[model samples]
Target: MARCPKQRKKAVIAAVSAYLELLFNFINLLLRYYEALESEQEQAVEHVSSWETPIARQLARNSFMRCIVSHGDISCTMLVRMNCRTFQKLCMLLRDEGGLRCSWNIEIDEMVAIFLYTIAHNEKNRQLQATFRRSGETICRVIKLVLRSVLKLHSILLRKPKPVLHNSDDPKWKHFKNCLGALDGTIVNVRATKENQERYRNRKGTIGMNVLGVVDQNMEFIYCLAGWEGSAHDGRVLRDALIRPNGLKVPRGYYYLCDAGYSNCEGFLSPFRGQRYHLKEWGGRRPRSPEEIFNMRHSTARNGVERAFGILKMRWAILRETTWFSTKMVTKIVNACYLLHNFIRGENGADVFERLYVDEDPDEETEDVDEDLILHIQPTVEWSDFRQNLAQELWAARSWITS
Candidate 1:
């Protein structure tokens, strides 16, 4: 449609203006839609956050802590495996000596309580998160943190052994003069990679670590060596412990009573091999010979280590079960258990677990000591003669008493 030049130009200008107006209207509509969407998104975020407000979380945490603190000794003891007084003292010691500080959202007591609850119950991170009202990450971090703090107290918590004196009147210990304590090895289950599992497997076909524990007559741990493979022999582990710079220290002329798994060396006293060495075997019968009497007394004195191990396992459920933590962490947990055991024994008067679990008669069966395996230290002639002489003295003393 050819028209006059001025009329065509006016029509073209009007059409262009109409198109521009339409474009502006479309842009305005899009801007309004985007603004409405952003407002809705903001409202949705607020709604989600309102479900767990800071005040609400704080209240929940406070309520949980109040239940632990206010509820009597049974609640605290069952949960943390320690009475309220001991738990509070432990927290104070950790804060003052271990340098554990309260975090922004958590107190030191709460952190320690979390760690104790986890170990006492062998709880998983998810379980801890639900119980403590924390995230898994937070639970993991605090567990590790509290673990490290407890470890720092090893030097102070570990008891120093006092050798049995010459004039000792305790019937069980009086015979073994200059004896420090009893040392033995036990298997503790651990989780390892498939590649390393075979190395950790013990003769019983269990994947575990061999833990060497030395306990005084009072059933307090004096020294502990952990992390050895379960396949390791008790003597081999003891040798490693002796050679290490910070290993067990046995004074000159003093010895530790050991099971027949160890050699009768200079500083270790083991019962006569091929003889009745267990107290159960001596039940309902008097000693028929010097060796039997000596063995009976040795068994009585050395059973303290067994009781200590039993109490340790009974108190800490983590030790009884296979730990799911890494191998390194499991070792630390074992050490922590030893430390706590000593602490509890020293601090708590009349331990309820000890009263309940420790058998007064101690009729538990003993494993047959391996007589064929070569030990790190070969049996010494002098030590053997000394044991014979000691047996004779014990038999003579008993005969005099009967006479």
Candidate 2:
């Protein structure tokens, strides 16, 4: 039954040869992987060298940095929100000038890319991490670090209003008083959360964000109040603005316009009864007299506030996002947007309202909100000599309250 010696020897030799070949193949694969990693490192070094040159990392981001920095430092998240080029230059400048410490070891671009993809779009952080191959905590760290950087210059950036209307007839805002601008509030739609459903419930019976803002006659946001819960009354919001004595200072002889919800005083003004008693019990539906015409003019002028609010909502549609963020962060986000708006506009780019303020007629061809329809708009009196006289006649003149 024994096999031939030549046949057994041939089988043993074949098995040994196969094992040797497999070992060689595995060794080749490992060598190739090392070579690939080396090449990647060389490419990274080249990229950093190009960016390190005196040449701007990104002109747009650099320009934005230059502009905003005049006021103070800005956040990296905000910088990332800048155009790609802008972010590079901004980060470069921070490395060069800010003496800021970078906590994440990744290149500025990776951090910028992650945040840019986030706030600019409504994508979740998890999706961003997958696409960019980053961890959740790293993403969170970069965002917080940038916001903290931006907050440092808050004093210089978020300052009190000074009457820049240096002259009564200055061409700039043309005779607007101690007023930095008119103050007002609006509601943004939000999603209801289980814990705060009852709290954020608006009159429309849906959850939403309520924001209060102050803008100049030209529609530039001078300040804002973003922390109030949506369910808070407008009166309560106005009162809060007053309480921020150090926060929002309305210079003497300056004032903010308000609807009836606000308590009328010297620093603030409201229209006479106008034959209409209140919201539910307003008078018959029509503008019948000169007083009504005056009221129409008053409401027409104040519509600027509505226009400003509309632009803000339009700019950051995410304000309409249903998810909840900490109220504190939400407020900062709102301020950040306001500052950015002024930043991008680059000096009067968005001053249509300001132009409309002093002009008797900017758009003659477009019909003024149908005169007949004007009846529905409420009346508000300017708190100048006219307000004083009207108040005197009604014996409701308020002399106690002063700005």
Candidate 3:
């Protein structure tokens, strides 16, 4: 059972060497793992730092500027809804009068373009953000800034009422020589909450606002009073307008042609109540009575307001579609369109107006959408005589023509 000393020594040395080798390998593995852990921690810190860094804004200014310059006329008229000269004029107004000097790298021209494009095309914030290469918040802010700027030009855009000189030479307007303009109301669709829906609902069960406007012979809006609920009667709205501090007014000798929705009173003239008055009533048929002749002339002169409304609705699509905006904002939009309509007409000539009216038959002339039941009014002796005299004059003029 006893082993030799030499053999026993050799076995002990072999076991000790094996244990040392194992210890060395374990220490090397620990070092490698620590290095890998340190590298991962460094990478995590780098990733966190990168998120805090801000990126420069990309405005796409050159691209947009080039597009506008390349197709300058189209961009100015169709896209921006104004001629180049007018656009520049507005830009100046926004800077000086509107107090909208560009800040934070937003140019005045860009702000105006954004506002016009948004309303003219009825584009959403997201669409504008994508198109202009800007953020949604930036696009929205710019639109508001330019909107307020454009609205500042209201006093300049809206015309002042002036008397038309009496003339007997032109048959078309000779009878209306003293007429200042034509007055009418239009309905624009809008979105309202359930609580306010009834107030905004029209007879057709659609939410809308009744806008009263007066247009001169030049088809320029002289006065506009919007924000009346669709349920509000046109006559009531007009009455309110007459009482406002800066509302519609007619000089002693001047009057505005109105439909039956308005009462026949001083400073306001209306056609015969129970007679053929609308333009369609005389198509391909001569007027049968003197009252008919007067109505025809009255309707012809009143077409100015109808044509103005048509032009306004055609130019701004935002008015046609129901928008998710507050009632106040919608009212402002309507006013802004009216103001701009006058501005465009003043800047451009009658040809531009005629072109926009092409192929579009005039809408049926009506003062109110819900004026079917005419309200009878007992006119004062003076007003009654005035209307009778006017009608008689129209009849006498017609007799002269026939003879």
lDDT for each residue of candidate 3 in 39-117, tens digit (9 for 90 to 100)? 8876644333332333422325546755554557677677777777778877887798778878876788888888888
Worst 10 residues of 2 by lDDT: 362-371
**lDDT of candidates 1 onward, in order:** 0.85, 0.53, 0.76
Ranking by TM-score: 1, 3, 2
Q: Tell me the deviation in Å of residue 111 in model 3.
A: 0.4
TM-scores of the models, in the order given? 0.82, 0.57, 0.78
lDDT of 2 by residue, 1-403 (tens): 8879999999999998999899999999999999999998766444444344334345433544344334232343243333334456645543544333555356554554444445555466665544444456877787665555544434434434445345645333332344445667777655555898778788888776678887655555667777677899976776666566444555445556655566556566554454542322424444444344334333544555666676555545556565344556666666655654444333323333333433442100111121221111123454456565643433332223323
lDDT of 1 by residue, 152-203 (tens): 9988998776878788898789999978899999999999899999989999
In the order shown, the candidates' Cα RMSDs to the true structure are: 9.7, 12.7, 11.4
Deviating ranges (above 4 Å) for candidate 3: 1-59, 168-171, 351-353, 358-378, 399-403
Q: Score residue 347 of candidate 2 by CA lDDT.
A: 33
Question: Can you tell me which runs of candidate 1 are displaced by over 4 Å?
Answer: 1-51, 361-376, 399-403
